[model samples]
Structure formats: C-alpha cells, structure tokens
Target: MASQKPRILQDTRDMSWSLIPLVLLCLIIAGVASQCSFSPGGPSAGPVPTFDIDAGLEYDAKELGFPIRHPEAPEGWQANSGSRSIITGEEGGDSSTVGFITPAGRYVRFTQSDAGEAELVRFVAGESRTATDTREIDGRDWVVYGEEDAEPLWVADFGDVRILIGGSGDEAELTTFATAVGEAQPLEP
Candidate 1:
C-alpha cells in the first residue's frame, strides 16, 4: 500500500500557490515603509533641503538624487549656465541632472549617469569606446573611459566639483586638477 502522507514534491507544489500571496504581502509592507520614510512629495532620495553654501548652485536636490558631499568647483571653471538643474531626457526617457560650467571656454556638463558620461566622451573623441575602468569614490562606484588614439581621461562632477584628467597623462597634472576641483558633497537620501 502507498504511504498516506503526501509526497514532498506534491506538498511543495501545493504550497507554491501560497507563495504569491506572501510576496504580495512583503511588497505591500515595503511600499508602506518607503512611503513613511521617504519625502512627503514622494520617494525622494538626494540632497537635504536645509543644505546651503555661499558658492553652491541651488536646485531641487530631491530631483537630481545623486549622492555628493561637500563639493567644490574646479579652478578657472565658473558656472556658465544650468548649474544644479535637471536636464530632461529626450521625449520620455531617463533624465540626467547636472551642474554646468565652462572649462577653458568649452561647455562641459557634469552628471551622475555613467552612460551619459560615456556618451559625452564618445562625442568628444569621435569614437564608440576603447577601454573602461571601475573607480571608487567615497565608497561608491564610478567609471572611467578611454579611447584608442586619445589620452585616457574621464570626467565626473559630484555636486559642484568637476573632475577631468587624463588617465595616462602626467600624474602630477591629474593630481593638481583633482585637488583643485576638491572633494564633493555626498548625496543624501
């Protein structure tokens, strides 16, 4: 005679139906917790409203949502336009917000999006890509890209600080530029 107890596979198959409900319950709890913890406007995650600085570019930090900390602008680079502003994406895609400045009389914008940064580098170098690097800043991951014929360089501006340097160029020059730009403020949730 067969055993009266249900087989393990059969029992698991039967219990599978309840898993959906459990997942839903967890999702609901997460949603509610996020709503309670996030900003009143919605799930906001960047910059505190109370942060203020004399030379700081002011914008809706909630919208930019990139973590930066105590940022300082690069030397000889002044805010040209679009500082601390959200640059909307084409049509209805992901938007990138950045602080814009003119370096060496050239328009350069800084954002938190690595894709956008790569695009910008490609545009400047007139190529698709050659190499890339994973960098850590304030314990967060950032990327560096290089082209085949051009000197290796990458740029990222956290908050107001602008960083642009050749990856393989004079190390002293890169250090100078980095130091001149200074460290940026960490983005807050």
Candidate 2:
C-alpha cells in the first residue's frame, strides 16, 4: 500500500507536468482572441452571418408542400440566408424564405408560399401595399407594389404557388432578383 501511494502520486505529478504546455497553449489562444483587430464600426454594422444555401434548400425543399423553384443569382449577388418558415393564423401556411444581398450590397429576400398573393405580400412587406405598375420579364408578368417611404415589393404567381419578393432594394435590384427566380432550376450545391 505504501509503494502504491508513491506510484499514484508520481503518476499524478507526471500528468500535471504534461498538461502545462496545453494550458499555455490555451492561454495563448485566449490572448490572441482578445487582441483581434476589427474595423471601427458601431453595432449597427456588425458582421452579418453567412448561411448555407444548399443545406437550407435541402431542408426547405422537402417541406415546401407545393411545387416551387428556387433561384440561383448571377455573380456579384449572394444568397445570405434561407430557411423553412411557418406562418400562423392560416391553415397549411408553410413557406420558404430566402434572403439575399444585391451586388451593390442592399438586402433582399424572397418568400415562396402557398398562401394567397395578399397574404404573402402582407407577410413579406408587413405593411399595407401599394400596387405601382406592371413589368414583363422573360414572358412572365409581375406586379410591382411598394411605398416610397418603405421597401418595394414585387409579387408574382406561379400556377401552384405565390412568390413575394421584397427587400430594401429598388426596382432594378428587385427586377434582377425576380428574373433569377423566374429562371430558377432544381436546387444544387
């Protein structure tokens, strides 16, 4: 028992010594993290999170409940985030929402849903809508709705689903997004 006690204590001392380098590495990492350099900016300009478009599509495409297409933006435009969204107060109100950033850095989004045009427009805009004008692109008709004081909205309907694209973007940005959506294909990574 006496010999066993010394052996155990020696083992513990050896293990403690072996952990010294690991502890130092952890301290170095923490110090490096604390000293990280960032540009001068307020919280209003915090880093935006990037989302996996392919993964989000894989998840939302399975539960869209209606046949709809997802768009692939041209270069310089980026898909920001996407997920499956469920709208309450309506039966079978499952929807898919995808946010994007325009080439000029404006934020935009498209909500694909089985809801009616009014419901979808209200959901995307979250305010009263003003139908401005009609624009035809690639043989499809889209109605423009928005306010000068708020983000503009573009609403279009496929045969089975309603698409409401709205964002803090102008008619040109929205038009570009709508064109991509209209020419969308099956999701691919």
Candidate 3:
C-alpha cells in the first residue's frame, strides 16, 4: 500500500459530513423561530366560526319534539356557535344553545330547553349562582343571577320551556338579545 489514512480519522471525517444536514436543519429552525411573534396578552382577534341558527333551530325542534325559537340577531351580532344536547339531572330534557358575538366584541349565549328553571340555571350558569334580581324585557320577566359577576345569567320561563341567556355581555347587550329572543317565533317542526 502506498499510504493508508488512520481508521479513526476516516471515521471522524465521515461523522462530520453526516452532521452537516442536521446542523443546517437546526439553523433553519432557529431562523424561522426568530422571525415569529406572539401577542403579549389578551385574546387575539381572528375570524369567528359561523353557525347556522335557522338550521340548528329547525333540527332541534324536530328532534327534541319541542318548539325551538329562532331569535333574530341584533344589528352587527353574529352567531358563532350552536349545539344540541340533553340536560342531565332529575329534570333532564333536551337543550339547544346558540352563542353570539355582540357588536362590542362580547359574547352572549342563548339556551332554550324543556328542562326546569333550576336545572336550566344550573346547567347554563352554575351551581354556585343565586337569583339576584328580576327584569322585565319586552313584556317577559327575566330572572337575573350572578349579577355582581362580570357575566350575569338571566332566565325566562315560558310555560313548558325555559330560556337562559348569559355570557360576558353587559346589561345593554343582554337586554338587546333578550328583546330579540322575546320577539322571535318558534321554528316549525
């Protein structure tokens, strides 16, 4: 043999070449991470998911065997989410809920169900809440609960059904929504 490289040196050179791709990948990831930014705090503004209120109401009414009211959203209000579920408890029944984003960027949830007042309040608000006051909106009496908190819960009984409206909305926003719900017509099953 004319000249032979040491086996250790040859292995070291091969290992260095194998590490080149991993080094480049690490550098690329660092560059991308350095260019990224995040919000300091608070909720980020983004497109909200849209919910079909009419279709939801129709489906709930037919499936639940109860009238589901279709509230006309206030100007600039958008229905962002909705769902149908059974209220579990001694007074369990079918429940339909729709969440709205108010014009002021606050949230309001409307729940309609055949569940009793206590069950509805517990389900929509919380078990720790208490009835604080009652307000008449659009000729309907709404029992207010947890009014001292940022988001208060309001419930209205309509014979066989109960409607609960609550969320981060203020009194004005809640009133506007309650009025809308009060004026709404039940969807045809």
Candidate 4:
C-alpha cells in the first residue's frame, strides 16, 4: 500500500510557528511609538513635595507653638473610653469641638458648626502650629505644614482636612502619627 500524502493546509501549520516573531515585532514597534509620544514634565503635573516626609521631623509650623487647649467635641459626639475631657469654646461666634487624647490610644472628637463656620479652628490648632504651603509630592497636590520637632502635616484638599489631635503616647509617637496622617490622601473636595 502507498503512504498517504500530507494535505497543503496541514503543512501550513508547521510554517505558522515562524510567524510568532513577526507578531512580536509589531507589538514592540507599537509600544515604542506610544512611549515616544509621552512627554515628561508636562503642564498640569500633579502637585507633590520635594522632600521625604517619612524622615525626621522638621520645624516650620512648630514655631507657631502647640495648641493652647483641646477644643470641645461637637454635640452628639461620643467620647471613646479613656478619652479626656474636652473644652468647648463659645458657640455661634467661634464654634468649637472638644475632645481628649488618652495615652491609651483613645480619642474623642466632636464636630459642630454654626454661622457657616465648621468646627475647623480646633482641628487646626489642636496639634503643632505648622506653616502650610501647597506642594506637589508624588503626583499629588498637598497642603503641607512644616513643624519643629514634629512631622510635617500634608493636607489634601479632598474632603475637609481633619486634624489628629491626641492619643496617649510619647512626643516621638505623636510626631510619627501626625506625619503619617498628614501623608494620607483626604476625600476629594
């Protein structure tokens, strides 16, 4: 008996293997073209700072001095266990939220607002007074405040910036927590 002959279509399969390189070459060319079109340092570069925030604390806002007192918590704000007593300032004119930070990682935050002003003053003054500036760090715009012997606070214009006032700890821990909180991204405003 004669051996069967191979079909033409069947033979094409073996040669198809060679086409793989051609396909890869096309992909490479496309990738290179796309990359070339991208420009570095273009306008609208997101705001970011030029320094490493994770490093030691720097003084800028620190000169402003520490907050005179912890503002009072807003109405309906519940105090966490071990939370210290908060002093509420005048209502309407100044409006304040009072709360305490315990050394045991307990904090009570009260939010109140009247006459259009929210409970923001206490939030801003509760911690170290830092000089704030708009800066671009890692492709994002942050309102960064520099404090002496304290970590800089980076405020994003996202949601209303909330300041972390107290949680019982040494000076170093407080500084670290403030810095970490500053680096976080707030809700988009």
Per-residue lDDT tens digits of candidate 3, residues 1-189? 739667756886688998999998988887788964556896578997899887888888888866789988999999999988888889879899999998888999999999988888878765757788999997899999875545788999877789999999988999988998899888777
Best by lDDT: 3
The TM-score between candidate 1 and the true structure equals 0.35
lDDT of 3 at 114: 94
lDDT of 1 by residue, 109-185 (tens): 33333234545455445566654775554443444665556565556544333234443334334444444344544
Superior by TM-score: candidate 1 or candidate 2: 2
Per-model tally of clashing residue pairs: 11, 0, 0, 27
Tell me the lDDT of model 4 at 140.
Answer: 46
- Write down the RMSD of all candidates, one decimal each: 17.6, 10.1, 5.8, 19.1
* Candidate 1 runs further than 4 Å off: 1-60, 68-70, 83-108, 114-127, 132-144, 148-182, 187-189
Per-model TM values vs. the true structure = 0.35, 0.70, 0.78, 0.22
Our tally of clashes for model 1 stands at 11
Candidate 4, 51-170: lDDT as tens digits: 221121122112212221222233333333222223344422222233334344434332222311222333444653544555554454544454556444434332322343332344
For candidate 3, the 10 contiguous residues with the lowest summed lDDT are 35-44
Q: Which ten residues in a row have the lowest lDDT in candidate 2?
A: 1-10
lDDT of each: 0.45, 0.75, 0.86, 0.38
Cα lDDT for residue 152, model 2? 75
Please list the residue runs of candidate 2 whose C-alpha ends up more than 4 Å from where it truly belongs after superposition: 1-47, 89-92, 186-189
Residue 18 alpha-carbon offset, candidate 2, angstroms: 47
